[model samples]
Target: MVSKLKSANASAAGQITSRSPRQIAWRRFRRNKVGMVSAGISIVVLMLSLFAPVVCKILGINPDELNLDLIDSSGIPTLPNGGISWEHPLGLTPGIGRDLLANLLYGSRISFLVAFLTTGLAIFIGLIVGIVGGYFRGRIDDYLGRFTDFLLAFPAFFMIVALSEPMVARIQETGIAQGNGARVIFLIFFLSFFGWPGFSRLVRSQVLSLRERDFVTAAQAMGASRKRIIFKELMPNLWAPVIVVVSLSLPGYLAAEAVFSFLGIGIQPPATTWGILLDNARRFVTVYPNFFLITAGSLVLVVLAFNLVGDALRDALDPRSER
Candidate 1:
């Protein structure tokens, strides 16, 4: 009877330990109502952006196609007269007569794409640099550390602003980045280039603490290859912090892309982005405040949603958090 009882207890313990770290983290995240709601909002925004064409069709408006009929003699979209209609839900651009809803959907596509792609690239580069540097401390670490410091010393935004116009112009002139596609790629590269160093530093710090842990030492003693230890052993342990960094950094990248667009260095005409929309709306802000309000409001909502989600993730994943 005692043997049977011991066996049952063992089985129960195994069942309790079956849950993976990811599953546990997810359970914790779901408990945070604010985070869960923000995540849902972010998902909805992404879907709307991804399916902008279909959304536009359902709404019966063309984002890029001109609607000169809607424009007045002064070239401003007919205001309150044009405001909040079934055909143009968010009203129309004052001077251009483009559907505000359609433009917003398309613009969201650019903003979200830039933020995610740049963050992905930065994470990839940072991971490689940090893992290698931290694993092989000494000369390799010194060289990489200096390079990262050098990058951090510069004002990243200023560098982007100064280089964007000339770099974009050259790419266009060379037929390298001709259309909106080229501009998007350029922005991705530009943002990723400036963004990686911070993450690299973060990863390097974490790696420094982890490299001396027992698992790493045990892996080394067992004749595991350096690459194997770094990728298989070390990488798994780094996921928690990496995820937190990625989440926190996304909003910053989104804001940067918007700033680039607003400054005329981002996606240009024929390509509707929130930043570009804001740039155009600014001219008619006095006469038609709706145009500016709609675009700015959308930007604010996305940024705020991302920030809230990130904060929630940080708290949820924090091992010390009681929640």
Candidate 2:
């Protein structure tokens, strides 16, 4: 009877162990109402941005093709001659007869793309620096830690702006980035270099704490090579903090991209961005407040959703969080 009971318990434990960490995370994440709600919002926004062509078709607007005939900057119609109608939902802008809905959708695409790409780049760079600094731990770690601090001390935006114009000109001269693709790639790289230090510092801090744990010590004792220990052992342990940080950093990166574009250094004309749309919309806010409200309001919602989700994940994954 005792032997049979022990066998049943082992079977139940084995079944429980079969579930992956991601599957477990999803289960916990779904139970949190705010996380689920914000996740739903994020998904909807991403879908809208991804299927922009369909949206443009339904809205009956060409995002890029402009109409020169219409009066450029008409405000919202209150009286018979106040100017806006159902045809122009958000009303017209200063000098461009472009569809506000279409431009907003197009800009969403750029903003989303920049966020996704830059986050990926930042994580990759951070992971490499972090793993190296943490695993080696000595003069190497000290040097890297100090250097990251030094980089962080600078005013990031001003530095990016100062670097951008010269870099873009240099790339154009090299005939490397004469077109849109090159320009986008350069922008991605530019953002990546400046962005990684923060993530690297975060990862390094996590690694320092994790490396002294019993599992890592055991792995080292088992004759595991440094590569195997770092990649197989340490990397797996780092995923929780990584996921939380990435989700939080995404919105910030998107906002930064918008700021860059607004300043005329990011995705230029013919390639609209949420920041650029807001920049153009600023002049007509007093006239047609809806123009600013819809575009800027949407930007705020997207950023807030990401931030809220990140906050929930951090709480859920916290060591002190109740099981």
Alpha-carbon local distance difference test for all models = 0.86, 0.80
Residue-by-residue lDDT tens digits, candidate 2, 193-226: 7789988988888888889999899989999899
Q: Which stretches of candidate 2 lie over 4 Å from their true place?
A: 1-24, 67-94, 179-183
Query: lDDT per residue, candidate 1, 80-147, as tens digits?
Result: 65556887899888777888899899888888899999999999999999888887889999999999
Which residue pairs overlap in candidate 1's backbone?
77-94
Q: Clashing residue pairs in candidate 2, if any?
A: none
Clashes of 1: 1
Instruction: State each model's C-alpha RMSD to the native.
Output: 2.5, 3.7
Q: How accurate is candidate 2 locally (lDDT)?
A: 0.80
Candidate 1 at residue 194, lDDT?
A: 75
